[model samples]
Target: MLYSQYLYQDDKPFKTTIRNYNASDFNQLIDIQKECFPPPFPSDLWWTKDQLANHVHIFPDGAICAEVEGELAGSITTLIADNHGEDHTWEEVTDNGSIGTHDPNGNVLYVVDISVRHKYRKTGMGKLLMQSLYHLVVHLQLEAVLGGSRMPGYEKVKNQMSPQKYFEGIITGEHNDPVVSFLMKAGRSPIKLLPNYLDDPESDDFGVLMEWKNPFLEKRKHFF
Candidate 1:
């Protein structure tokens, strides 16, 4: 569907490709993490070389990225896990970003990290990545796609409403959030609110659990 209109560079539509990233993409990915999450975001939390390598070796299918002119434009890293339908933090579920718990047989495609470089944002890059994920879900016969989304807009209205209420507001159209709203439009729905999900002051340490269920889930079950 995203046939055109990718991130523009110098007022021209830059050629971009979405594909499974390889080891050569390691350094660019690190730079991308720095560009996406700058100071005060805890330098220790950025993507490490070892962790990125682990992703390529452990679950190459889940580690994907967007590229423009041989350079990374953005990326999405994921792992497979059984859906426990419980509350948990990013670090706890993603094995502290190493994704050592990846299981190909798991029913859920758990998104660990999704970052679009500053300039490449709002340009359908993220949307394309998500679309790719949905296709992967169906291909793997998985139940759904799951991710924890930061509520960056929450901090601005924290005094007026609780995090849960704010998330509900996004769901009910009472509020518009950059991250969660985008995910919603991409076919995901909020499952619950996760408190203290990350060290993010902008989100007030709050996050939203989201899911995009596979439409062919029942068909896959019938076949099995």
Candidate 2:
């Protein structure tokens, strides 16, 4: 979709548009992944170009990228899942990060990956990516959007706090976790803490399950 309106972050203007992922963006996506997630990066924590291309093949419209002035600023990849009445670890749902388990007919929209280029971060690209997903949720009439958020700055305090306390700290403004804070403001509520969810230690080897309910679903439930 062509996003014409401008959003500013860090006092810089960002004019972005969300579009379906294409074969040409593979290299750029790889670069963004590396930059956003630094060393100690486990192979399973990230998707290779080939794997992402396969995802596009499985569900073309499920993956989206944000472009600013013809440059790929960020991307959000998603898949359909049949997660009902159960909590799933990141690996189980993403098939160890290959996303081979994506089911097109599933009711819940599973967010597989999201990233913003380092230079383009704080430019509101992430929020726009989320808005795009919300739009997809409404258009497709999905139940909700589900994903996991890494506690990026948790390593500094892991020795002194439990994952639960850390999460509460972030929610209560006692700690500043960029990823969690962003997701919280984007309307995704924290479902629970996931232990050993990702191999990357920067996330403190943990992730928080988050969900954004489809407003349409709530409205429909009222009528039924």
Candidate 3:
């Protein structure tokens, strides 16, 4: 139900632990979101404390967090979506920015949100969290992991290129948007380029619909 990783730097060991959400993590989640995301994060995207409390209560393992030396460094939240049965945008699944639904039997692991504290951005914490999610996909026997990836560098070239062009550039390595680049390197493929997916200038108000198929899913289903 929980996991941990140890890394060494300067001959010292730092432990990063991944675990399910709890009541006390509410404030830290808020702080991490404020630091990692641009100003005025849509209220619906970041829920109120009471709402998050309810969410964790309903789907305890749906949310996971990473801590380094007992301090919160990153977090990831997921929901089950039946992407194989129908097509739905991030907004529709998230209830127009509010994390309003989670279908446990759905075949897709919908990564509703993921973030790392600003201070730990460049470190490997984010990757560890992602690896944990990948394992989670295997553990749950899901079809794939799906989400809308941000384009942090979009503002710099929004006027110079269209959303599709920008997305292609990133896919082709011509553009170096941090989030999309990271996802691509992690083996996720873009399902489509979404325009105005979120109202963020830093991302040029765009998002890339991304998916990472689970290679073991079919085998697991066959055995089960």
Candidate 4:
């Protein structure tokens, strides 16, 4: 079989197109999430049809999806927050929490999640999704974009080791994950690490706080 045939199980060509997400797209969006995340978020957390339709309510105006020939390929969520100063004290209240610190006018873009299908890994779809989010952030005149990177886990090697050891490996790799490469490429800098910050008792997971300033902003300096 040809490469395209093997990948899509059909002879159709691959074409990626991005558009604002709608309520009708929920099931397809959930399917893409399942294909992308190893331990995917529960179905309850997946944005419902009503949620996607109200993009401004759940996220920023440009929150979008990339569909390849009518099939959901990836999705991204963006939002804004107020400047809360130097201390991330509010993080104590939430695991995937986001806050925008030090905005006199209270303007900052927070990218909540970005995911792409497994078969499309390393194909620039991730970057494309990010670029789309960035454009939305810029269009909204946000001060900056903030997000976190999770450490990769044993799903890539689950069959070879005990679950405990697999989690250990994930924690180890989290401290040294190559995510830094992508962040640096996107003009972002690592600000801090929240150790053992998750709500789940069994989760040894931590989070890395990162930020990317808007290069177009004038008189930019330290926020806090």
Superior candidate under TM-score, 2 versus 4: 2
Query: What's the TM-score of each model vs. the native?
Result: 0.90, 0.90, 0.88, 0.67
Model 2 gets an lDDT of 0.79
**Stretches of candidate 2 exceeding 4 Å from the true structure:** 9-12, 218-224
Q: Which of the two, 3 or 4, has more TM-score? A: 3
Alpha-carbon error at 103 in model 3, in Å? 1.0
- Candidate rank order under TM-score: 2, 1, 3, 4
* Candidate 1 vs 3: which has more TM-score: 1
lDDT of each: 0.84, 0.79, 0.75, 0.55
Per-residue lDDT for 96-178 in model 4, tens only?
33312222255766555677877665666677677766676676677777765544433355467644454344345542344
Per residue, candidate 3 scores C-alpha lDDT tens digits across 1-224 of 48778855555668888998788988988878777775644644564687567558666777889988778888888877766323455677765534567778777888877888876666677777877778888888887888888887877887898888888898788988889888777677777767667766677677788887789854532211
Q: Which ten-residue region of model 1 has the weakest summed lDDT?
A: 1-10
Best by TM-score: 2
List runs of model 1 lying over 4 Å from the truth.
Answer: 1-12, 219-224
**Deviating ranges (above 4 Å) for candidate 4:** 1-14, 40-60, 84-105, 153-181, 196-203
- Candidate 2, residues 31-121, lDDT tens digits: the string is 7787777777674456687778887888887878987787888888888887632545778888766678988787778888889887776
